[model samples]
Target: MQETLTRLTFPLSTTSAPCSEEEFVARFNQRPGKEARMGYDCPLCRNKEFVLRVENGFHRPYACRCVTIRQNLTRLRNRGLLELYERCTFENYHVTEEWQRGARDCALSFQKSPLDGWFFISGPSGCGKTHLCTAIASQLILSGHDVQIHRWVEWAAQAKAAVTDSGAYAALVQPLKDCEVLYLDDFLKVQHGTRPTAADIRLAFEVLDTRYNTPDKPVLLSSELSLRQIAALDEALAGRIAERSRNHAVQIGSAPGRNYRFK
Candidate 1:
């Protein structure tokens, strides 16, 4: 079968190394048909996105490494997070302090085992909270999970606008309640650093409670307010967040060197 496949495949090279994405595109004048094919550029799996391997005296289809790349790109693009995903990778995340390193570890843990539980990081601006959350979103995308990057301030505004229209409200907010992964950045964050209003607290409970009841679907959050601060405003919402993120929560203080903005 190996010999048969080798003989049938066209325009594939002898080298085992795969072509870079740029090189692959350069090899073809136009994108292949809607369906994948054994095109000229891809030597690994010949562009079928999966390869057949001998197993139990039969051949089984196994996903190629390249499939992961394509999936990540597609999902990121669809969710409008491609640029951020490319930029805020775990590899490029800077860690200058011990607490920062711990925060990164928490994000990595959640990214690796998303079904495990929720992850939270609360810190001042320029503390790399969004970067870590973006890192998690990228990894979740790479691992074939749909991630919703919820900029909480903007999201809340949209939800608030649609509140009077039941259909529009559900259209705007229902996805967050049931998304595979929801990364809420700046949860309950007020512009002047004031506490959230009763409405903000209620909106948070409406969305968060759904995820709270469904433990299998995990969440990621970054906020300027720490869990304790959130508890002071509304203990029920904060308690659920604290319990879910118990294992993977890290709060970076405003102590000297904690805020990278000064540097």
Candidate 2:
């Protein structure tokens, strides 16, 4: 019975294991397409298709390395971790010739070494802080690193919720903690026309403290706040970020006749 069962489950081939002739007949009857179609023969072992039991079920297709490679490429692209430049619209980014050069240089630097240190882009509103940061993120992702982009306000809200609702909070926190590169878009001291509240200050401090002082991963902050203004928002947090970052700060400003890309 065991011998018959084995033959019934697997197709017979020259390279295939031996089984009772009755089992082969039973399997041929049970599997509608087994007989009419070419019998299972290992592609690697022979030039024909073979039956392989994959996780889901029996596949009457020979294993091809190309399938695995294609699947991996599809997964990487779908994850939005590749094709970073395509994700952000670059032609829409407006900046002066000099600032554009600087932005390109920063992007190249990040592409080469995404784990270097924190990057803080700060300046007045409409100066393309977020655009440049997004560009950097896109470049890093194309280079095969995991990247996360978030708005400052959105992150603040999640952190606040995490304080009270641990589960919901962990959903946000775990990603931030695990991501290879984190981009905080429009980071600043105010939200909804109000100055940074006590809670806001605490939340910012906790995130920066954990990321900068603990495992010491790189973070990117795009903000309209100037360096001095940032320092004023939370002196300790600003000080720590400044001390830990490589470039200290990046100031993006507008040149006359240039349209702002961040608006």
Per-candidate clash tally: 0, 0
The TM-scores of all predictions, comma-separated, are 0.72, 0.60
Cα error, candidate 2, residue 173 (Å): 2.0
* Predicted structure 1: lDDT: 0.75
Runs in model 1 lying further than 4 Å from the true structure: 1-80, 257-263
Give every collision pair in model 1: none
Candidate 2 local distance difference test against the native: 0.59
Candidate 2, number of clashes: 0
Model 1 RMSD in angstroms: 8.8
